[model samples]
Target: MNKILSILAVGMVGACSAVSAADIIGTVTYKGAAPAEKTITPILDDPTCGASYNGKAPTTHFYAVGANGEFGDVIVSLKDTTGSTGASAAPAVMDQKACLYTPTILTVQTGQKLIVKNSDPVLHNVHLNPTVAENEKANEASINAAQMPNGADLNYSFVKPEKFLKFQCDVHPWMFAWVTIVDSPYYSQTGADGKFVIKNVPPGKYTIVANHRKAGEKTQDIEVKDASVTINFTFEPK
Candidate 1:
């Protein structure tokens, strides 16, 4: 009986060790001069939409670089990983306020719910245009739905991974957003401060990727053991 108990204790310890995980923390920055953002003149010309901006037009968010060059809206993730609990994960949200998408860029795992809300007082439509060929089901998930003023939220999800799936407003041509669907839970989008963290990654080697819609992508190979790892990336203006 004692020998059996010892064997069971060893098995328990092995099971505990197998669940060990670490985190990946990183920062994304931009190098060189960022291109000038042009103002969307049509937004100011519109009657209802223009009123939300208080007579000032909004410029494009193509380069969301901070004062110190910290890059925002960049998707940092583990490449080629496939274990996603997105179906049960909390739904991601995108809001339309003042004739613009609150977050011009977003990241969600495959099968995760994306809730789109229109906070504007005018009429708007949520148009999803996915162009990936690898996942036919995801490509067929394209939808164009009209959302009335402060109307009901539109919900969507993808069955496979896709990059930069575009969401545009047909009513307001300048309003747009990009959603990158990752197949793994090990992904994060950099905030305005350009920082991100991917948590609970098991001890192993991984290919970390940082992708920007306009600046392109950067990748690095990394190994994680018991402790967390830090990796940084810099993207130059295109």
Candidate 2:
């Protein structure tokens, strides 16, 4: 009887240890001189969506850096994480307003839903061109569809992992965005303050990778025990 009680106690302790979880929080900074800003002609004279910008050529948001070198729109994700328990049922959105794609960088998990919205009062076509690998010729995917003025949203999902899916509005010619489809929920994008937090990470060793649309990428390996782990990454231009 005592032996059986001891076995049950051991099992309970093991289960408790297996349930350990932690948070990964960090800030991503840019080193050296901030990247140069890029801009495209909004063609405000176009008698269509261009009017939404109020006859102003807006600066491109491809690489946004603060006065202190804070980097925005950097994707921080864990490598080799596989599972589907943390994804939310709520859909991710990419809004089109003023001839631009809001939150120019979007990240979503495999099988997750994405809603693309057009907020302007002009016709715009959302074109998605995914870089196809040599072996994926038969699986190449593309989306070239128009959204009417104040039109219905475009709902989409990708079944496989893709690093960068370029988005553009062929109608506007100046509209651009990118979507990243990941398999794990352990991912985040740095905000205008260059800060990000990834919570509820299972205790384990992981290689965390950070990527910016233009500043390039950096990686760091870390081991998370029962408590939170803080890691920061810096990216510099070549």
Give the Cα lDDT of each candidate. Answer: 0.88, 0.79
Which 10 consecutive residues of model 2 have the lowest summed lDDT?
A: 133-142
Over 4 Å off in model 1, which ranges? Answer: 1-18, 133-142
All candidates: CA RMSD in angstroms?
A: 5.3, 5.5
What lDDT tens digits, residue by residue, belong to model 2 across residues 172-195?
777888988777888888899999
lDDT of 2 at 82: 67
TM-score, every prediction = 0.89, 0.85
Which pairs, if any, clash in model 1?
A: none
